[model samples]
Target: MLPEIITPIPGPRSRELAGKLRRHESQNVTYLAEDFPVFWQRAAGTNVWDADGNRYLDLTSAFGVSGLGHTNPQVRAALVAQSADLLHAMGDVHPTAVKTELCAQLSALTFERWGAGPGKVVLGNSGSDAIEAALKTSLLYTGNAGVIAFTGAYHGLGLGALSTVGIPFFREPFRTQLKEFATLLPYPFGPAGDMLRLRKELVATIQRRAIGCILVEPIQGRGGCVVPPAEFLPMLRTVCDEYGLLLVLDEIYTGFNRTGALFACEDSKVVPDIVCLGKALTGGFPLSACVGRADVMDAWPPSSGEALHTTTFLGNPLGCAMALAALAEHARPAVAAQVQASGQRLKSALEKMRSPHIWNVRGRGLMLGVELIKADGAPFTDLAIAIVTRALQDGLLLLADGPASNVLSITPPFSIDDEEIAFVAARLQEYLTALPGSIS
Candidate 1:
């Protein structure tokens, strides 16, 4: 029921709106260049209808936020019901019943591996704040100021989270201030990086120096949806254990049945000390949490200790209530199994393309990537942009990421139907075929 492009994208109304928005926004980073910025009028399960009445199969899922689908009925009901009851509560000082219930669900779901008395949950408004909280927790637990992060991994943009950012372009502006806190390591991907050597280097760095923790993305999101080698996480776990450093896994993108498994870490049986979750955690609301081991979380006991971290909107009632519903949605075994099956189906379709512009298709679960290679076998940055632009024209919504922002990241909602997936793949093929170079 998609591909309803009655008018060219950015029809008169859309153009007018984009022009107005341009006045109040930075055009460089906002709109995709080729197509008109179709203003969204409404959205439903896996599809978005623009102001012009043109519909698009939402492949990116609003940057991985609406996992259960846009304005999901359950989430909307929870939001409406909670808002009507009691909206605000003092977060850490005074908590509500919904807040306590939400935390109980999160604790019950996560600490299944570690036979736990009680794991702690600290709430925040965004993924970045949750990550920043984890960083502080790590520092407190180990009583050290140093941390380790991998190349091409994106944790968040806050000072503490940004310090662990591996991309030079994102970190270069703030490097002068961030260098004193964290060390960067090569992520175990590609052909050349030796895991054993990297492991030894990490151990040496953490043991000799005052390293408190190592932050990693269980499945890199902003970094081209890269799924590092299978052994990579377990090796890091071993290194962290040996070095006495807490392992903080950022599951902002990989959690909530996005990665086929309950959490991507479960695939390898590696338990991290601290886990940061966001994006789809609250279905489609602004909620994030840093849940971890008790000893690590209890680093800041409330007796005259410098208030380690606190956000104004922490443990928001509406957000918590919505998250409770989202987690319940995640718990359904059907959701997890469907994500794995759909991911494989899409991956197989991409692999069958045989396009010369494609370098390779890599990733897991609903999160996948089509890495572009030039005719010379090097990365084709411009072509990737062109492909995305062309895909937009064909009524498909896809985006690019990675350090270069050259890889086509295909993260459709987990709830997409088979027909919708086929349409997306067909649109991609049409775009590739229209390019000048031969695909085969």
Candidate 2:
């Protein structure tokens, strides 16, 4: 379904909310502007209703978290049912049965499916939590402090995960707060031609530094949905094996059919030692899981009753139940194929048009990026921002992605129909066609 514009973009109600938010909330948190920041009242499927009653076709999927669509019925029902049964649980002590079941299902979905046996899980509240969990697990298992991560990669902003983050913009300011344990290598694109050189460097780095693991996003989400060559994961897996280092896949954004696979790494069949998952895990709940092979995760010593690493809401009942429901939906055999078909339709439409402002269109499934650029070939960061602002007025929500913020990212929900895909491409075409002359 296409978006319907009612009141002006942010309209009166959104402006009121923005003013209140600016006064009480951290100024650094949300960007405040007259024509921006629509306060979402409610969302469902692929549509979002704002405070001003404006309905927009969601292209962001709320930062790629609602892959099963916003407020999925089954997930919502499970969440409500779980709340009636148990509002909270002492995670480290007396955990809920929902958590137990969720963990078992996660093991079967991941390691068991890969023929790696059952996996152990560390539950968390956010994507960052999952990243940190994987980092800690890798450290515990390999007993090495150093980590290898690719440049242009984003693995969340938590302190432990921050050290391994490749975006200099995020890492530079907090460099002092972060441990000097991560080595950032350039992320490759195009063919696997230069992979040999990269492999040599990676091997040397592993030997020279006390590297515990190689952390990566199978399809770099925040990094402009950058899809590396098919050899990427296989290469990492081979090196990690040779050096006896863990291969940690941060599938937070690329998991749950976002990349037309249960996990993007599945396309390569490269089973990771640790997989950090979140975003679409519970469809709309604050939940995440860091799953690792049983043997690898067993590196952690048994809890001395007190539990060394535990959160108050480690396995929240509401989130766990929602996750169970989302998992069942994601397991549908047709989901991945449907996503792939939708992706091709959108990709083909975007590629058919030629514009000076368009640099490239790339990515898989619903996770795609239109690389906005200037006539001079430099990144059109300003143009991308302008497009997002303009698109919001058109009852379409979009986000500029990557460390440079020059990629117009499209991460719509799987529930988006063919008509919705056509609408997105049409809107994007208009933006692309109009931006060249505007860019300076």
Candidate 3:
């Protein structure tokens, strides 16, 4: 009894709000269509209601932030309780009891999951902040400024993180201001990708440059949820070991049971020197962590009066409490199992469709993507847009991702039921089967 579309997609109120936003906000900040952006009023579990009272099944999970589902009762209660007790605290200078507790919990969880002995964590306000911390940690630990990053990588848009992003357009405008510290390499996708060549390239790059770290995503999320070969991460670990490079894994999207494991690196048994975690960390509240081996984290000297890399909201009480509650809920065995099952079900359904337009279907757990292609095997970007737009009209919220924006990113909340999954598949089939012979 979901996806009750009482009005046209985006409707009147949404368009009005969007128009107001266009007048006030920066043009570059809004990605959705100017005239047709859906303005959400409320959300619960896997359903979101737009301003026009149109209910839709939320598949993007609000850009994968609401992993525990929108307005999770436990996380909401924790946030409320923490706000009443203590909302703000002096960050880094005078830490609160909740901050201390959250740090301890994160450290213990990292150690237990990744097998890093006595892990240490540095909390930040967002994924970009966590990536910045990891980058600084790499520089401090190895005494080298050079970094090795992979193609299709998206650390963040901050100046430091943006420099490491793989997409050229994201870095083009600020090329002069950004440092040339990172060297980009191709991430292995399948058997066609040459591991030996990549290994040689990595070795040569390390030998030539003062490279200190190799930053990569276990499964490239924005790069269309591209999953590398089984041996890719393990081989990267080997390369890191041979060259004494710190391996920094950005798990901002793949972490917290999104990939059927607490962390995607767990599948390959590859423990990184530094791991960046965010997105679903606090179940929607802004919280992120840069966790690493104790020895590596000890590179920075003890703080005196002024800490070097501390933010004003380093460990907000509300974020800490909600993060603690979210982690406890996600760590449940049943949750992980359900994610695995849901991912399998969705993948199987997508595979069954097997349209000529689909170039590939890939991903693990709930972070899935469908790559669309033309007869000539070129990326069908317009078709992707049309499909997603159609899906929206049908009361299903979908997102497009990838360098070419031709992959349908199907990341739903872990709480999505089988019926919703079936509906999504059926709607996708209907749209794809009815694709016009030629899209402009």
Score each candidate by Cα lDDT: 0.83, 0.89, 0.89
Cα lDDT of model 2 by residue, 1-440, tens digit: 68988888788999999999999999889999988899999999999999999999999999998888888899999989888889898988999888999999999999999999999999999989988888888888888988999999898888888888888999999888988889999898856548888899898898799999999988898988888988988999999888899999999999999989989998998999999999999988899999999999999899989876778999999999999999999999798988898888878887876677788899999999989778788888988898898899888899999888999999888878888877777877787667545535
Question: Candidate 3 on 1-440: residue-level lDDT in tens?
Answer: 35999988779899888888889999898765743578999999999999999999998988888878999999999999998989899979888988888878887777645566777889999899999999999999999999999888989999999989998869899999999999999988964678888999999999999999999999999888899988889889999998888999999999999999988999998988888999998988889999888899999889888889989999999999999999898889898898999899988988887578888899999999999988998889988988888888888999989988899999999888888888999989888888674332
- Candidate 2 weakest lDDT stretch, 10 residues: 431-440
**Candidate 1 Cα deviation (angstroms), residue 300:** 1.5
Listing every candidate in turn, what is its Cα RMSD in Å to the true structure after a full C-alpha superposition? 2.1, 1.2, 1.4
lDDT of 3: 0.89
lDDT of 1 at 133: 88
Worst 10 residues of 3 by lDDT: 431-440
lDDT of residue 291 for candidate 3? 89
Candidate no. 2 TM-score: 0.98
